[model samples]
Target: MPVAVVLPGALNPLAGCVPPFDRCGARARHATGPWASSQGTQILENGDAVDLTWVESAGAPVIVKEESLRNLWGGYVNSDYENACEVDGYAGLVTFGEPTATVTGLVINEIPAPTAFMEEYRSIVQWISSSSDARFVEMVREGIASVSMWDEGPIVRVNGPLAIFDAALPGTEAGADELLLVEIESDTPAPARESIGWIP
Candidate 1:
């Protein structure tokens, strides 16, 4: 199960929690079509239904209503997507203490919006300025905190609106530095449930 999140030692708050994706891939990676009908609940082999959230997946961030699990923030819907950071493989997390090397870009308050920081690098402000979905706009409130692309991709990199990496760009919070960006790494996109990880 290539479980991506890798927080060190006791630093990980969501230690015992079940990561959304299994070795096969993400449970509810996309959010559309039949997936939208499922409404964030997956049925077990024993005929039980479990509530799903925007949890983790092996590869490829999804935003389609049918394909997306629930929330825009992939991987366990915590307080804010920023909370899990490294635990979810996102860089530029909103840390509580002083800034770490992974952090960069403008401090949260200084920027007009989270998307502002990426303007220089990706030109996201233009797209965000035209969005209508409030949640999509709200999605960028967290991090990639590295918000620093690894010569790889955008910060949110989600499938929904604010997903700069989504090819639909747009686009946090916390302490003074907590608002600062952090480091992010990219993983190869996992094929759909039946392709690479899970057996159809």
Candidate 2:
């Protein structure tokens, strides 16, 4: 069985559609550290390498949990914020998915604050809303809306299946901001072990 790892939205474009697992013979000689045969797993370094086992596991197609979705979106938001901002006080929630064989739990973090952090977050949300890709908004509407640590300080609760405009406000407790939350959910339940195969 062939495997492909599904990186979060932030890394997917750079990772390409197929797994980048076998790079040992390439001119660049990418190194994916250690293979754990017992667990039927391979660990790749954090760069652009892919893990076939991870891909196959995700290929099984299973529903992810709400908390898990929050984490995934939060992680992507943090990474993007870090690269753009460079401080721990700024972040954004891009998208999220439910728990599944491929992934589980919420991934959240504090990103370095950037001077234009709010603007960047607003731009990202606007981009998603206006993008031609309907799937982007659809996925977000399926799961719970997650707020970053920075956004959470003033928010008590996010609302709706499509909570794009109801996210908590960063400052001033009196009103909600225009920040939107995109939820990601799927009907596919967790896959059975028989449905997944391990690579040697």
Q: Give RMSD (Å) of candidate 1 vs. truth.
A: 19.5
Q: What does candidate 2's lDDT look like per residue over 17-133, in tens digits?
A: 121123452211111222112122223332322211210111111111232123333221223212212222222223223334333211122210000011212212111121222
Q: What TM-score would candidate 1 get against the native?
A: 0.20
lDDT of 1 by residue, 1-200 (tens): 01111111112233222333456743322222222332245454456444322211112221111112122332233322234322332223332222342222111111111222222122222111223222222332222233443222223222222222210111111112111121222342431110011000
Q: Number of clashes in model 1?
A: 31
The true-versus-predicted C-alpha distance at residue 179 of model 1, in Å, is 19
Q: Give lDDT: candidate 1, residue 91.
A: 24
Against the true structure, what is each candidate's TM-score?
0.20, 0.17
